[model samples]
Target: MDEIDDSQNPGFPPPSPTKENWRNQYYAYRSPSGEIHYLLLSDFYGHLVKTSEDVIGSRFIKKKLQTATIEDKNEAFKELKPHALALMKDKFGSRVIKSFFEHGLDLQRKGLAEELFGNVYTLSLDQYGCRVIQKALELVDMDQKIKIVRELDNHVNTCLYDDKASHVIRKCVECVPEEHIGVIVSVCVDQIVKLAQHTPGNYILQSILKYCKNTLTQKRVIDGIVSSLVILANNGFGNYVVQCAVEHGKPEDRSKIVEKLAENIVEVSLNRFGSGAIQKCLVFGSHCDRKLILNVILGSTDRNEPLQTIVKGQSGKFVVRTLLKTCDDEQRELILLRIKIHCLEKYLPQED
Candidate 1:
């Protein structure tokens, strides 16, 4: 057991259980007579925690949890259940805990979850602890799932932006039913613009769009970004949310976004990121929505001024190109003629 400190050995995989030095390594131990003996899975009674903290030992325990008999697993669980939370935070012990959830029986998982009851929030945010919480969310029953996700009530704001914790919140949104995860909806409770403009928060909003399939639920999420349509459209990171909204949102929602961008079609089409929103609206919006955007760009259709301005600008040029690609033949002819005439006038400057 003293040799469990792995710093002393630099060998690639350490010694295998089948190797000659197995009895002399970390799993090697002493008998009641004070003589050394080989430690087997059956002998994993009192030493589960210590050996689990070792890299090799934890790997061995996880394998046993996977394929070992119920009695062999229960033997390790007897000693492990008490230390569940602490080991959840352990570097190596956490993986062992995850493996247990993966293969442990229901009663055993319930027992393990009880040990994790009040600590779900802390564990959800913890580096190693988060892994265990995610595993439980994926594997635990709904009643238990609600309990674990509910612990994240007020902590979601911090969790939403956190590198590690955000995944837990995302997992809850993903796996938990729409009715039970009001806590996730509450992160965007205000449904404000900043939520869409926020870089990290975009992921949550995107998940809400993709997974929260209920009408009112999806509406709440779509409205949140639509409310900030113009702001998000012009933004760097926020534009992704807008594009996602157009792709996933209802037709009316797409119309709403196109209408908003049409308010300043030329400028929006000229913006670095806002142009994407316009192109997305073209790709996904109704025919009326496409023409609504096109007319805005085709400002003063009788003249070539609007066509020239949009075609001249670098960003707006792409919007026009995308429009040509996505628009129908009738609309393409009208726009293409102006473009043809404009190129002739610019290149055929023989008024010298």
Candidate 2:
């Protein structure tokens, strides 16, 4: 077939599937006499394979020439416009067929599993199409399940660096049964620590760690066990997640696990330097440290200045109110009198 003409011949009409000129069904034949033959233009098939090199650009012209050829230059030019029109019509139909087949395959897998399992199989897992495999395994043969897993593994491996793989793995882990959680937990934690160690903002690793929060033991002693694992895996990593861990040690028991963990550092300071860990606590934390500061203010003879600082800090409403309400009558009266003296104006609530 000749290339498309680039000269002033009006370009071929836009492609369409219905227009016909030559062989339509894509079949070309060789005669017994060693001559090549195509369906005659008289047949619908022949008309369908029409060539159009004169009107379109080189690429489109080349593609059209793949199936047939033109005998006369004038007839070929006449054919070119219709050929381009047919290409446009065929393109949409081809795309629809492609998408239909793809989605059909997915649905077939789902339907087959549902048929076999009746109600037992549930498509719950999240690994590369593993949910389909998980559902299918319940009803169909075990071999089919293995095939599905292997196929999914291939696709997943190809996308190791893609953002979606991390999410897919987390979903896979969640869909895993409780009996298998321990194994998945260990692997996830190890991988997360490794991936996030260099750059702490690694979203995937951070996601894995956040998910681990659900798996961690809530018991204080057991929490220590988990804390040890975290430290060993992620020691010296000073990211927001680590800071989160510092705050996370508080269990309902509130047995002072933080104090227990840091006691050695505090003790080494001796009386001269006081407790180093406690000092750090004062610096790093404000909520729990407020109690210590309040005791100091209450015990001091000249309480006006310290009380004024607490009032100006605006913690006096919630914190001071709760403290007074929880205290003995004498202590509550002293606080109220102090508030009357130094903080009466700010006590009024502003309306929105």
Candidate 3:
């Protein structure tokens, strides 16, 4: 065989031993502004797709997807389609996928959503993939939103409890249309207490209370949580679920929560987290319930020892301030008097 050295052929460039050297062989050019800018010899989109698995390459693709022209972004999406699932599961590639959903053209976004249609649940449950699913839910149209929500229909509770998947489930509750919202609510409602007590699941339940617009559905959620009011109120994450219930629950539901807390006011008020729930009660509880809470804190007309103890503590001070803001004039005077007597004056603002 005759030896042919590529370096001897003027028309052909010598091959580099490694891909990194080959990539570096492409050089930076100085522009009219005197700034050096690197340029790619091959199509930028094609280069990115070829090296999509490389960390630096994937980030470049994400940046281009973010700042590129719509036409260029469409081309990038087409190039990445074949590896969509794999990219979605890749830590770096997932970000590129998310950027496509965020900045791609309408057709590009729709096409990407369609491609991920059947696998929405799987993506929503994967740590990196869940992020892509969340972006789609926020930016895609209603029909696609319905499709994504439907994929999650069978796994609503499962996603609610998973650390990463819970976020997607919450997004679905917030953005999906009413019909799809009904599907999520129906699956989650019966498990409200169980979900509320869970670390991540509580977030999904709170989203249900915040976004599920049907008055009847809201009531059902409230009724479910209220049945376990004390337990939820005392829980670390469950307390926020209680707070959301009070903030969004019906008037009657709010009263029930207030009554439950009132029964254990001092105990809850002294808790590190439960105190916030009690303060929420003061803000949203009925006028009568407010009076009831004050009575429990101040004791009878003669003694204000509980009020003294609460104002002196950390979390309880916030609850006491909330009380001062909402209390009637007579109630306010009594609370102020107790503050003065206890010499916890520093916790209270001095009148101007």
- In angstroms, how far off is 220's CA in candidate 2? 12
Return the clash pairs for model 3, or none: none
User: How badly does each model clash, as a count of residue pairs?
Assistant: 0, 20, 0
lDDT of 2 at 76: 30
Global lDDT of model 2: 0.36
Quote the positional error of residue 335 for candidate 2 in Å.
16
Worst window of 10 by summed lDDT in candidate 2: 118-127
Model 1's TM-score against the true structure? 0.77
Which 10 residues in a row give candidate 1 its minimum summed lDDT?
343-352
- List model 1 lDDT by residue over 1-352, tens digit each: 3423334444323344433344333355444344554555676666788868877788778766777788888888888888888899999999999999999988888888887889988887799998898898899888998998778887888887777887888788888998888767866646547766666677777777777778887777677776767788889878988898889888887788788889878778778899888889899989999898788777765665656776676677778888887899999997777778667334221222
Predicted candidate 2 versus true structure: per-residue lDDT over 69-147, tens digit per residue: 4332223334332332233224332222222222234443343433323221111222323333332443344444434
Q: What does each candidate score in C-alpha RMSD?
A: 7.0, 17.1, 6.4
Worst 10 residues of 3 by lDDT: 9-18
Query: Model 3 residue 49 lDDT?
Result: 51
Q: Per-residue lDDT of 1-352 in model 3, one digit per residue for the tens? A: 2222333333212222233432343333344444444543234545555456656556555555666775676667778888888888888778878878887888888888887888988888788999989999999999999888888888877887899988998898889866666777887888887888888788888888877778888778888887888888889989999999889887888888888888888778878889999989898888998998998898865658788778777778888988999989998998888888778889753334
The candidates, ranked best first by TM-score, are 3, 1, 2
lDDT of each: 0.78, 0.36, 0.78
